[model samples]
Target chain A: MSVNISKPSFQPYTGEKARISRAFDYLILVLALFLFIGSFHLHFALTVGDWDFWVDWKDRQWWPLVTPLMGITFPAAVQAVLWEKFRLPFGATLCVTALLIGTWVARIFAYHLWNYFPINMVLPATMLPGALVLDVILMLSNSLTVTAIFGGAAFALLFYPSNWPIFGMFHVPVEYGNGQLTVADLFGFEYIRTGMPEYLRIIERGTLRTYGQYATPLSAFCSALLCSLMYTLWWYIGKWFATVRYLNKI
Target chain B: MATTSEQLPVSLESDSKIPWYLQDLPLYLKGFGILTVIYIGLRLYQGAFAVASGLDSSEPAFEQYWMQLFYVELAVIAVFVTSVWGYLWFSRDRNLDQLSPKDEIRRYFTLTMWISIYTFAVYWAGSYFAEQDNSWHQVAIRDTPFTANHIIEFYFNFPLYIILGGSAWLYARTRLPLYAKGISLPLTLAVVGPFMILVSVGFNEWGHTFWFREEFFAAPIHWGFVIGVWFALGVGGILLQAVSRLIELLDMLEEAP
Candidate 1:
């Protein structure tokens, strides 16, 4: 009598295994959406909070400089994991999109509906264009150094121009009360926020005022320099946090 | 032939019908639905009472409208943390060493759902209501730490997410063999790091005592919360760990006929 036996062979996941993997992917997608929205928004709101909160705060100097400097952080960190491990390159886009969604929801519910603040006053600036460029640079070059220098620079430089259309009209000089003030300033004045006196508003302050129209460009470039360093640092931070090692004890 | 189960003595049901791997999906969907209703209900409550009664914490109306709700929230949190955490702990698998590959894979799926739910809660605390705190502060003076938004955001939302995150941590540590043998670093970071956000609330309210009027969202005083949220990035590490383990488990199973 002869006995027939089958051997176990390793094969690529198919059918049920493939389905299970896809299900896990979907689950991760949901988890990632909330994760990015919650974590990134909190970070952005705290670090670059006021600048992103009000249109009047969207000044040429601080707004353009600080927004990208802070905004590049989560994207760079997320890209470090998504790109390096999974070879997915949409990390920057994902973070920016999540932040946008979160800010929009807050602006609508928190500011507009709750406090009756005009939507225009609480409009959030977009970093989508710059985020796209960051992702593309990382995808194409696949080198951290190259992505940091060029991609980080592009992220900062694009902030002002991309948001120019939404806010450029607000910056148009208007003669109000025999003093020169922009429409954004007028909005700030009309809507009196508690504890936020005119003096507290940090906009266009410094010797950079001597440069006049050149201040924005100067700030953008300075931000670009800082963002490059910030991106590199956060990339490492992402990698550090993404460690798969298990400890014997915490 | 696939590797036979030697460690685990748990027997599969000898029925013609094959069991679905994602058996816990329905429960996950129900969890999402319940959480949505609860969050939306809280937001609606804020909308109704915030402007009228929330501006003055010292008043009788404030006590009735806000403080009562605060007390109720505290009660709910206490009951919730105890029940859910106790259930997860008490129901932990004693024979994790003998867990079948299929059962382990299913546990991973369940673990993901727990984390996904936790992140959903984080969305409310960190994103929606956190920014709304600024809007509320702009309109209403922060005379006390237990302002309208703080009643919901800091006290309720923070603790709720912390509980859910703790639930996920406990679920993994108790059920999964690998997690049982060695504590997962990324998992701990993701859970414990966010728990510190609750601690930061004390520091934050204390800092606000000096300048209770100004609502500078990005000020250095708020940096503690920022530092706390960054640990959420450890989800990336958790993903790496889960994916590698799942791959190994999937390889050990026989192909579906």
Candidate 2:
């Protein structure tokens, strides 16, 4: 006559439920991986796709502004959830992996679809170190405020140095037209994009005489300021995303 | 369906020292079923369109079909949005207190699945095709928004996620007790964040129109779209609450049988 099940100490999820749980973990991991790859593509395409495509758009003035601004939200928000939920700081690494995977996906198709634009021309520069810096800062400091200030600055400050290995050779001097041009500018010119006219390029039109040698450092500093604020904003946004409270049952 | 005869395996609900969690088998299966169908549908849609258009940006049929397809997509999206919202309004449960815990868990499972679908659509539409948009835009002269890339990326792809988000919201609002009385804040965020990306398309167009006409993904004007991505961070919040409730249900089920 009793409807209620009685209690004893043993595992109920031993065979079938354990199998189901393992399946569930696999399912969730696949879903999470798909999300990671797709989000990077989505975020990077809208935020930095243009600068990434053409070296001409990689100006000291704007690249710093756009890259870090676009990049910080992801790591900050990811760090928020990871740190809050699991005490993990792998957000930056996850983001970097996602971005690299996204670029590889894009580059594969671009190589075939767009008259085989050379891999060197279309492959995106890596930002893995920036993401690592963001994660390491959070782990070491264990303070969002400190992470936002110092970690954010490091995230911005580190981008150029990290990516420079792949792109530094391109920044080398080359003789083109009337004066000196970096090999990057020459590569962009040689690619022959029919849609992208030479005039449409929004590169720094002014001479190095106008910019002085300190242009890169100044740009990195300003980007640090911009990225710190962005990191703080997104860090709070991440906290909001990490919310687990609910209203009353009814 | 545990009975006392089945050695009284510790009931997750009644046992004083027992934990309250079971990884409900039924609910998990149902959610998985729903997400799989949606993913299959997405692949079909993408495949069929790719076959139809040949993905050539400059072919005459490409432009002609894409422009018309854009209009058709707008209409389809409009219909979906209104119908789901209207359905939720009519289907609102009057008896919130008596709602079954089993059904509530099922609703949460469905909610999570829809959100998963939303994320899946985001993968195909936002990240996959969106990046592809960058690749092809540099290849083709973009005279209008109805280019092959925009057709796949903006018109067709972006709206796919919007519809998914809308469905998740509708499911929660109509069925889940937490969302029954009014909107749940995290749920609203989960819904609104991606919808705003659809809204920001206008800003994206305006910016691309006036100033930055390149495929620069990290342009400042493009910053708004990332905000939409940040909103997707709500998935974390939503999962936390839903899993907590699931654990509670597991406890109930553990004791019930």
Per model, how many backbone clashes are there? 1, 11
TM (chain A), candidate 1:
0.94
Comparing only chain B with the true structure, the TM-scores of all models are 0.93, 0.73
RMSD in order of candidates: 6.7, 8.7
- Among the numbered candidates, top TM-score falls to 1
Interface RMSD of 1: 0.9
Docking class of 2: acceptable
Best by DockQ: 1
Q: Interface RMSD (Å) of model 2? A: 4.2
Per-model TM against the reference: 0.94, 0.75
User: How well does each candidate reproduce the native contacts, as fnat?
Assistant: 0.85, 0.52
